[model samples]
Target: MSAKRMQLFAFFISVTLIWGCQLEEQEFIPDVSGIEAEVDIRRFDQALFQLDTNDMQPELQKLMEAYPELSTLYFTHILRANDPRTAPDGPAPYVKGFLQHESVRNLYDSVQVHYPNMSDIEAELEQAFRFFQYYFPDEPVPNVSTLISEYAIAAFVYGENDLGISLDYFLGQDYPYQKLNPRDPAFSAYLTRTFNREHLTSKAIQTLINGLVPPARQQRLLDLMVNNGKKLYILDKLLPYAPDSIKLEVTGPQAEWLEDNELEMWAFLIKEDLMYETDNRKIRKLVDYSPHSPGMPEEAPGRTANWVGWQIIRAYMEKHPETTMQELIALEDAQGLLDASRYKPGR
Candidate 1:
């Protein structure tokens, strides 16, 4: 086998390594383990079990009367409080992790041991959230991933930096950065910094969405959004609500250029949505403050809909189920997907 094939083989095994570890169980807590990490699990899960949820579900229903996020908010916070160590890096990527070891099996195993109401309630809530695509957007997420191309997903969601994970990378180990530093007083202080929670500002909403959905689901979800029309998501317009901390400028010609290519449009939108909060400034800034993330200098692939290339490859795989794992993984990147010639950027 070739070098690329070896990597694919490793990735497949890597995925298989996590089974009993339900990464999605990350209702809270950081992704990393082995460092008194399991304590967060015990404290947080038990704390939730002890909450005064007395007939609160229906009352809680009043707030979320509209969407699952409404309900997810209160519950996740309950989890966040007890598991005070994740942030900046966020917890969604960990959510996609497999239950690699049995350390936390007892956490789930004991769900019924204490809070019998939880065993079913947790699954019920996740089920309700399954209908929409959840990703990171400045707005309250609709259940899709904002990490468009595999790059963002790989780093932010999959926990792997294409540049390779480094201590220098500010994101801070992606998953553990989210769980907060158990050694810091700031973790407790930072948890309460949400004075603006109720208003549900663009930034807050995006944070919640990422916390709710896993990267694996988000990846498949990028497909769902593209399959749904590549451009009709009504939420796209509301993203400007986020503060202008991040900025960019996309000239009209670029917009028009992108308009002609729906696939590019799809890819661009997903790409932009993924970076709603970052300041890297690599993507083309189509709107004020918000730019096509993965920020760069000028013309990049698919201005509006970046997910198109990814989806096309997915479509191909669906049609050709016989394709090898190596073949499929090779088509995972932005350039790889585009080079397939299926996506004609600025066409």
Candidate 2:
């Protein structure tokens, strides 16, 4: 071939590669400007902490009035305190005791400093729920409320219309979670690394998604993967602007590792005959949160199988563009979905 022709060929290949990458990165973000969804964020933490200790009873009454269901959940479930209305000593003693605790007070103060204003979070959620409405127009958007759960819980969805976010759980990676409670296994470094503002919105949306998606009935590894993958897919649609690392609840390096080893990971799964493995203990190692996927390299993030399942779902959706989100979710045959995906990793 002529030198000029060779140069043109190389340039064309580069342009095609770049265009393909740009196309891959392109997300189909629907126009949510017309969606009439709004996030009603209540500062429950601020209100409860600012209550007057001197006149605690009426103050508690006012709080209960302001947040009837949430207040009850706070007392009974979150704090594990006696119900204020039915307790022998009433709400004052519990309120005063909680306020007077040195550790709890300090935690609340840290939460305030870290989250001085939740306007940014509120706006992000507003956009997410707008997308939610765009996808599930019949479903009602939940009211959001913030609290200081003292590391007890990160986020919770109450019934169909209320979502609570625990501010203390998201106090960033430098909050010394282990130092605060070394005995608690849940405060491990691998998990707490995600305890930051960047993960707040994604975590909240994940909680909501969990409530919306049906629980997996089959106990096999593939069923769990597809079930969790469906949830992740829905979450991706909801938080279209969130980073994949945040949605996957992994560090940047971990996310990179998953992307680089996609084919290897899938091969490992198939070679080991783990796809149909129904042992709960065996399945948990691959799908559950941990330092790394057991039996895989240290670089392989926990929930590695879940990420693969996500790719399968992505492949299926790409191959069958006519399948709607609702339809994809409604189709429960994991094996059939995998077969239809024709999911060749490098392709």
Candidate 3:
């Protein structure tokens, strides 16, 4: 009824609205636009399977002749010999069996059918590599080599100057050979979400980043979370064109749930004081990749702690505008980052 009371009411309402808007507002990290570097990803899988050879010896010799440099890696690493002692003696006796196996042929055929021309994926790799070179000029851009493997466990394997993609691993989720029928949670997670073509480039880039910036020391849970967060943040920067789901490696609903409960998740971590706890079980459950994060509600996605840590790093970057990507990568002090972040959620 009073003039001052009405003014106070309007001011409070405006404050509430502004605060709510701030909570909902996501900081837009820009994509690396118009990167010109052309990365010609070498197709090791194609070269390996080009010949329909019942005679393994000649084909093996031809492969060695074709890719002299990569042949060593292919034999030693990819198609590992049953006996390594006699290995560069060329095709071990069992090599014939490996080459002629129906499963092996099927896997090779699937990859060939799925990825006839990797030009688009190559361009995506080139763009990500360009950003990497842009940020860290001293580092070398690795030569990409795509191949198929029996295990398909390590989807993207990296070395100092070479990157390898396991093609069979990316042959869509429902690929009959995926072993999803075993009903294992871990296998299900891999097949349902990660085992897809879209994830290849992102995984490759992340692997490169990981090699450059080794995992932070895991003395405390906070350290692990921050390190994981750093990786995700770098991934976000490198693959800016990638959707949040792909970058975060979460489903659509999972991403949405995390975004909605970001503030609540932060509060839960603080209240529980799990950030600095040294218990491996608790830390793994929170930080490691799983179907869902342990100790949180069923609605929460896996790695909620890492998500919170990413937000903290994002907040810290916001507060300290001078912090470069390289500096962020090199940053080892989890506590310092958390303090600098001044990350008060739902404010």
Candidate 4:
């Protein structure tokens, strides 16, 4: 062959190889249309806010009857108010007081304006749950509800089959979370940046994962990382359409930083021998919610180790496509999983 033709042939082969790798990395979107799942997000915030303060007794009774478990949970846990069923005066006084509070009312109004309808969120969750049913057909789908919890809880799974979302906590990034009285340090800019509609479905599915997945047997850094990785992998399966930034709970730049530094981070962990370390404080530095991971560069996002573990699990799954999610979760040996994963970064 002529020299020019040979170079062109080589270039074409290289292009084909790169394209093949990209296709392999693309998310595996399963056909979930055949899976039947329904998600109707009951607007508890509207019902509570629209109560008849002048004559709240009858309406409160109706609310209690309608949302038996959720109303009790709201009063007892979210609001810290006396349970209406057991209280001497019932929840009328407390409900009335809460409804009349200027700050609470303002918060509710903002929630309504931001989320005039939960149809979009409901549809996203329904799709996620359909994936859930596709993976685990025997598990019952939870009944979903939305509420404004005065910033107490973001998302929670209660009583085995109920999932609740606190809408006020997700009032977008532009909301003045810092201006609220008794400001919480947890509401820092880095954290609250994710407090928007884009993350609602991921957060809800994460809540369900927490409820379903068993806790790690050991407290070693590797165990925690692998445990969190299992959850993230399952989350990836459930939310195939969500970006890695949303799934990892990191900003776009942060996600890019992690991806770019994957090999460096892995080397750092191995050289320092930090994975088997079981100290809670050290583990928290690598896995907890924070601006950046300690002992790493400032650009490294918190939960760095968890992201590494997720990659390991991904590699392992790719290596063994037949391994089921249940089997992966039940495989408690973190070290074993890592060895089987053969996860060499930048390969």
Candidate 5:
């Protein structure tokens, strides 16, 4: 080839590479710096765990005195968590007992060993907070605190101005306790799937959003499904950086199965006329966290109804692109959404 022809080919390759780079850059994650909040995170776990057994009482006293925020957290969350018999004024003995518990000590050691550096999660929280600020500017960004929960009923509990993360709940999926008691009925599949550092921020955001959306109770199967779908859809927008597995609150295989069998699953539900059914047993099979979805293939994951609902909501949004998030949240008619969605899978 001539020199001129070679130069032209090289120019074409450079232009293609530049375009590819720009496209990759456009894939968006929440911009933390863009969020306008000076929200400070309090590491309650670190402070508590750092206490010396030799001077336990004095160390705790000094720690609380130094960080008043932690004092408030202990009185409000840790004390009550250790024992419901606790009161704000009389928490010293309870705190001492809580620290002395073998399980509590073990959890602390695991956390220290497993999650010595939370800088990445700290950054993730900032990004999530930024998204919260962007969507709801008027809402106060809650002060975040990380503490051990001693296996409390709630993992990520929150109030108007404070969000508490139970560090024990998010110790990796293969945490010794979870593995030892794999068949423990109390430990739901969803809880086990999302128990990791990667899900910490996403779960926090979900807890926050749950407060805004009053749950659907005793509603028809379809309504409950759509309500869940709406929540998940909101999450997709809010936590764009989260892996789909985290957002869906499922493992990768489960999500892939749902996607691959979308049409067949929808058909099964429709043919069986399960949408309008109000049978708790039937609805629970499709909606709740379990080993697998009942009445479907044994390989199908639980919450197939939720996956279908998510698809319907996505279809509705795409068809009606003019709808705002506020409008979507306010929508109560699940049947209307389905009708509007024209959701015919395999099309």
Candidate 6:
């Protein structure tokens, strides 16, 4: 037989095999590429607002097309343009192949806060979630107790004196929505009630990122991560504060770890169910590492008065015993916060 003829025969066989292979449809997983969840909602929202959605990067466009789960990037671009300068009336002002859902577009304007605030980001995220809801309403809503646990986890990471939003906002609500629970474990309620769904997803992702998810609600997630051992936590804002190694749901034969630190802590902290203690930890941890002890500072430009001051106030109260939580939180000794090392242990 001629060599060219043999090559042609081989090529036809290869084409036949390629055409004969059956490909399974991939399950829908939320898209969260290149986004960090630990960021205060404001900054996260700001970042979204800043991306030049009009950019003609072919790869980024391909990424978006192949990974619609990350549609949040487009949303962020729309959010930036939502302003009068960009959109005199509304978002999606003139863009084609863009989405501008009501949940995100009409998310009420945010208040100007001096400290890190999570509300704007949270609200906008909730609005963003409407897309997910549109995509998967039948998928189970995250457990409320699970949500609270995750919220608490995020609050702890935010630390004291951060202008950033924390779980306290929800616990203080006058009217909380229906409480939801996971079906597994003992089938007990995770959150007594759910005041907000955006908060729910945010906290859940935060907890997962921080290794703080509650055990009852985490079993299925853990099992999935263990089996597949791929990327686990979902919040882009919270990812910056967390370590790189995460617990992902297992599938397609992957290596698994015994536990995911961020995820485990989220569950442990939630099951403990002590907001005040969690708050105390939030304040204390910030002070311990942020400025007082000076192990690391999260904000790059170095905002000095955040967690350090709150830690001093909380420590003073813990030592004094009679200090009220409100008074402690409201304390205004900027110098004292800066000089937290004076009160550490022996001082």
Error of 3 at 125 (Å): 1.6
In the range 181-248, model 5's lDDT, one tens digit per residue, is 77876565566757778888888878877766667644788888888888887787778867777887
Model 6, which residues run further than 4 Å from truth? 1-85, 88-97, 100-311, 335-342, 345-347
Question: Hey, what RMSD does candidate 2 come out at?
Answer: 8.8
Superposed Cα deviation of residue 71, candidate 3 (Å): 3.0
Clashes of 6: 40
Error of 2 at 249 (Å): 1.3
Q: Using Cα atoms with residue i matched to residue i, what is each candidate's TM-score against the true structure?
A: 0.24, 0.88, 0.84, 0.89, 0.79, 0.21
Task: Return the TM-score for candidate 5, rounded to 2 decimals.
Answer: 0.79
How much is 235 displaced in model 1, in angstroms?
19
How many residue pairs clash in all the candidates, one count each?
A: 38, 0, 0, 0, 0, 40
Candidate models: Cα lDDT each: 0.30, 0.82, 0.73, 0.83, 0.72, 0.30
Measured on C-alpha atoms, candidate 2 has an lDDT of 0.82
RMSD of each: 20.1, 8.8, 7.7, 8.9, 13.0, 26.6
* Alpha carbon deviation, residue 20, candidate 1 (Å): 46
lDDT of 6 by residue, 1-347 (tens): 44533443454344444543223324233454433323324333333333465652443455446434323333333234335676565444433222233422322121112213545545444443433243334433221110112222223222211222333234322322222234432122223222233343444444433332222222222222221111121232223332222211111121112121222222232233311132433334321222121222222111111212222343344455554323332334333322332223111
lDDT of 1 by residue, 65-163 (tens): 532442253334422311337433333322212122243343343333333333332232232222222222222212221111111111121221101
Cα lDDT tens digits for candidate 3, 240-326: 778888877888888888888876776576557676678888777678877778778887777888887788777788888788878
Candidate 3: list runs displaced more than 4 Å: 1-35, 51-62, 65-69, 85-92, 157-159, 177-186, 189-191
Ranking by TM-score: 4, 2, 3, 5, 1, 6
lDDT of 5 at 69: 65
Better of 4 and 5 by TM-score: 4
Candidate with maximal lDDT: 4
Task: Tell how far residue 90 is off in model 4, in angstroms.
Answer: 4.1
